[model samples]
Target: MLVAGSASPAEAGTGQLLVHLRSLLPGLAGALRQVANVILEDPAWASRATIVELAERSGTSPATVTRFCRTLGVAGYTELRVGIATEIGRADQAGWEVGIGADVLPTDPIDRVLRTLLAVDVQAMHETAAALDLSAVDAVADAVVAARRVDFYAAGGSAAVLEDQQLRMYRIGIATWTWADVHNGLTSAALLGPGDVAIALSHSGRTTETVEMLAEARRHGATTVAITNFSTSPIADVADHLLGTSVRETAFRAGAMSARHSQFLVLDLLYLAVAQRTHERSTEAFARTADAVAAHRTPYEPRARGGSARSADPQRGA
Candidate 1:
């Protein structure tokens, strides 16, 4: 939950709303879900519309809208409107604001689709970064750097993110491995001990396989970290450190689109923190790794594209 006075002006309006929406989406139901979806579809109108008007637009009643507002921790329709209006005002002030809840319909042109995709992804990253708890991130990074071994458990799209993180840590000389198969992941989790770190990535935080591995690792006394969209999920309950991403599922890109990007940003943030701690080793690893692959690539050829080209020396190749 966002604190009363924690968010800055830039982050207070739409940013906090996105956070709430992402967090509460999994639990929304019935007419409340419809109401929430309507608000997401058009924030500016939602901000200014009366309760009765919102109800008419959403195909629900004013009482249902009030119930939805209460679910979001707002006093009533009036407070909800105030919050939305605040976001709309702030968004208007910014020249290049993107709506987090915008969608790409099948009827949209290719260019329009591209614009919507880019806008939503960019907004998700911004909101995720804005809502990130840096202190928790620092703690997770410290745990990773100090761990005897690190195991990443993920599946589906999140599994891809896990593999990328594994490669990144390996490049920096940190011992990390990820498993896509649940049996293999569970087997790996079984070997983890008190000094080991187990990180789980799930969008809904309810994936049984991911949750089981995290539980197993926790049972074995490993420090557990969860990266997910919902903070109140089962994984969050078992995790020692929680890193959340605020990315809503759009009509076209529901499974892993914006969420994956947010996950990557979190992983990158953690990786950078770890890299900063062991700078010498990381730099040396980069140098050695670079040299190992340097001979495989063909050197630049001069005048291949009719540009200025004179030198063939490796350092000054065109």
Candidate 2:
């Protein structure tokens, strides 16, 4: 009872694909598009489809239905089912929702940190795969490389990410700056010129202060980039290009855990890529940075040896 080609990829559910059925339905040489519609409309039944069950539903042959699933990126109907379920599983778990259930307590320290890390990692992978636009990423990278200056800013928990990135870019000799305070962030943005770039980091992508800085940066004719979650959010709208991480977070979990992890990963990718592009400058900068740090070092005894030196001796310095 469904028309074909009416659904677009934009409207497709996470697990349920939208197929163009009108083109191949009872036309000059059509067979499977009709079947695809039947499948697309009710992904659950289609997921469990047998060739005969599917053939009867779409008025197509068993072989035709088998061909349809393969045509639509599945190995066969069985894969189509399991794949859809997996996608649905992902959809169900995305976003920030805290559980209020009775505390399930495990006192193992190592297990706790590992579990949290694993959860964040899983979320990061999902968010990245779901939201990453390769073309947009390439465009952002090209713009960063081509820019004369790049400024980045963050606040609250996201500040850690910007601090780390600031160090990395400083090492590679990119003309980069990071601001955690609002005063400096805005000041930095206000000074931007043409061919300059600004990057804003936020997990929720809706921080008023961060967005204001980004807005100001844009006014100065600099291109803006956002590393954030939620594509339809404010940061994504303001950015010239967006990069996202897929960490589903809840309120009760550790603060700043997932967001910090995602931001670091993105910055690392950009840092290494920029380094490769300007290998000579990066190498010199890295060596210079290392030398400067090494020059400031103070030799120190081991903690145990220092403690022994200060041991409470009854005879004072006789």
Candidate 3:
């Protein structure tokens, strides 16, 4: 069976909790999926209803409900209620600031707009991180480390993320290539075989080009990994491994805005994991690249009056 998201489980926060739960759907089966669907379809019910009532609504037995709660790492039904209620109270206290489903509006104040955009993107990153299957991440890391070459395919906003990954992996001295165009992606994928890795990024998991490229890579015997929002989409069908991100779209905050942020979270994790596998080499490569680039750039200096200057070298971030 495919492993689902969530490192352990989560106050912990039912709104966020529900997001985590939905990510686990790909790994659930039978009545478990039913119970999860019920709670997800109506979180107010999860926060307020009785266990027996939830069971009835889910069309499952009380035993199954209890099992489901346990699977989520809650002690039992009561704890689930407390957790959901805590999240509800937290949401109420946050007022409109949580911004889980709110959209940016032209009429809104600048602070409100900033808060909404930041809140949604921040929540997406946190939730995406929490829902990641570390074991899947590890497997991808292993494949990356062992592969002779890695090719990445992504279109639109996802291509920006792929470019970042390409740069990062290359900095660490790993052989990497990326293509944002369908023809180029397919051409690169055709050259991949047994020891190669092909990673495709698509928020909708239905991108025709990415799906076809991944399929072609698999046909050529490459290990395929898909980073996407939907676990069961056509892209996932062709991928040997699925890395999922949960990003809900608002009117103004579409896939390009928040979904790209979520995908970056996954890519950062994957990149770091690959780096960790080759710690000494990765460290040396980064230092070498930094030194090489530093020679070409002007030294950091405070701006003089009415003059501009570049920022300082990246110190360890706080």
lDDT of the candidates, in the order given: 0.80, 0.65, 0.79
Candidate with top lDDT is: 1
All candidates: CA RMSD (Å) = 4.7, 10.8, 7.1
TM-score, model 1 to reference:
0.81
Best TM-score among the predictions, by candidate number: 1
The predicted structure with the larger lDDT, 2 or 3, is 3
Better of 1 and 2 by lDDT: 1
Off by over 4 Å in 3: 1-17, 20-42, 49-96, 301-318
Per-residue accuracy of model 1 over 1-318 as CA lDDT, tens digit each:
333212322344443664666566667778988998888778888878888999999899988998887677676777787777765564455543455457888799999888887777777777788777788888888988899899999888889888999998999899999987889988999999998999999998899999999999999999999988876677887798888887878886775666888889999999999999989999999899989999999887566345455543446755
List, residue by residue over 213-257, the lDDT tens digit for candidate 2.
Answer: 988899899998887754445676678777765454444454245
Which residues of candidate 2, in runs, are more than 4 Å off? 1-84, 88-113, 126-131, 254-256, 298-318
TM-score of each: 0.81, 0.62, 0.74
Q: In candidate 1, which residue pairs get closer than 3 Å at backbone N, Cα or C atoms, i.e. clash? A: none
lDDT of 3: 0.79
**Candidate 3 per-residue C-alpha lDDT over 216-245 given as tens digits, one digit per residue, 9 for 90 to 100:** 999999999999876656787788888888
As a TM-score, model 2 comes out at: 0.62
